[model samples]
Target: MSFSNFLSGLKEKTNELKDEVLKFKNKNFLHAATAGSALIAMADGSIDSAEKQKMLKLIENNDALKVFKTSDVISSFTEFLNNFDFDKDVGESKACEALNRIKDNNVEARTVMRLILAIAASDGVFDQDEKIVAIKIAKELGLNPADFEL
Candidate 1:
């Protein structure tokens, strides 16, 4: 009921949100990496060796996701990639879950989508399959695929 008490509570809530955003950023980066790699791999029926190597390097070098074992990240990405073969929709759903985790952080979803778009285009030509998946992911994250411009 007191003004001072309300201000204190507001500060506490803000701090809590900041902490949650930090955690969400980490999770979002991981998911974006996973989704990006999957799109590249599924681009041409098979993921090229060069693309695989790049994906692995990206995951290994990202400091925020360092908490995840190299093997764990690779395994998770691979699982999603495999799912892309049997069911593209399922693969997109998995990627959406990763993006959704950070949606509460407001801008984190868009940031993650930007990362995904960059990776999708890293191979020079954006593969059609990957582009489709990226658009699906962007929409799922409440982002505009038009922003990525394929």
Candidate 2:
């Protein structure tokens, strides 16, 4: 490809990503989604490197989250992760509340739950602790545990 054509393609891809980001009507949805995923990552206690990568990968591929900037997602996840690390009681309470915001939107809530579960299983082992966290997140989102095979 010519230099100009390459630049054009790059610009087009950039615009597409920008449009996707703009398509996100509620930015809080991004925050809530990130927080929800972070909760699951910490469910098994400290998020191992592999688990962390899985969480990021899930967020990157989630249809509901793809509209967001990767950095934004990482920042939101960090905030929640740190909060939970600092104080499990207070942090979990806050994260759950944030997730509750999407309770009225079943589609969005389900998407978040699926993403969380995917992240939990990303390390190749969905342990008991991860399942517990997934259940809690499902409940917070007003979803039935049975729906997610919890």
Candidate 3:
């Protein structure tokens, strides 16, 4: 192939890679999932190491969430926690807003909520606090919390 053709092919490949990266990052989805999970995990007053690990494993194994990098998941989850650590109201509000973005996609929202519930229950004790948070999240996601038995 000529030099011009080689350059054209390289550019095309670069563009394709960029698009792939964008899909993989999926900023909003990652943020919402992580934040929502963190909130539920914190319902018991703190996210135990075991609970955090469970959430990580669930995210890694979950088909819908497997696309995100572990680092990205950790970062998003931590950001929400840090905000919560600083100010309860602010953190909850911000995380809720991020989760609210996916409300339009009901399927995704329900999947995320289910994942949160699993993580909260991972320690073998899904307490009432966690259940309430899940219900709150369900409502925020435009779902009936009662459907989840909240």
Number of the predicted model whose TM-score against the real structure is largest: 3
Tell me how many clashing residue pairs each candidate has.
0, 0, 0
lDDT for model 1, please: 0.69
* Cα lDDT listed for each candidate: 0.69, 0.84, 0.86
- How does residue 35 of candidate 1 score in lDDT? 70
Candidate 1 clashes between residue pairs 3 or more apart in a chain or in different chains? none
**Which parts of model 2 have CA positions greater than 4 angstroms off?**
1-24
Question: Which residue segments of model 1 deviate by more than 4 Å?
Answer: 1-29
RMSD of every prediction = 7.7, 4.9, 2.9
Which numbered prediction scores highest in lDDT against the true structure?
3
Question: Which parts of model 3 are misplaced by more than 4 Å?
Answer: 2-25
In candidate 2, residue 26 scores what lDDT?
56
Candidate 1 local lDDT, 42-108, one digit each (tens): 7566667666776777667666666666887787788778778779888767766766776666455
TM-score of each model, in listed order? 0.64, 0.81, 0.85
TM-score, candidate 2, is: 0.81
Q: Please estimate how well model 2 matches the true structure, expressed as its whole-model Cα lDDT.
A: 0.84
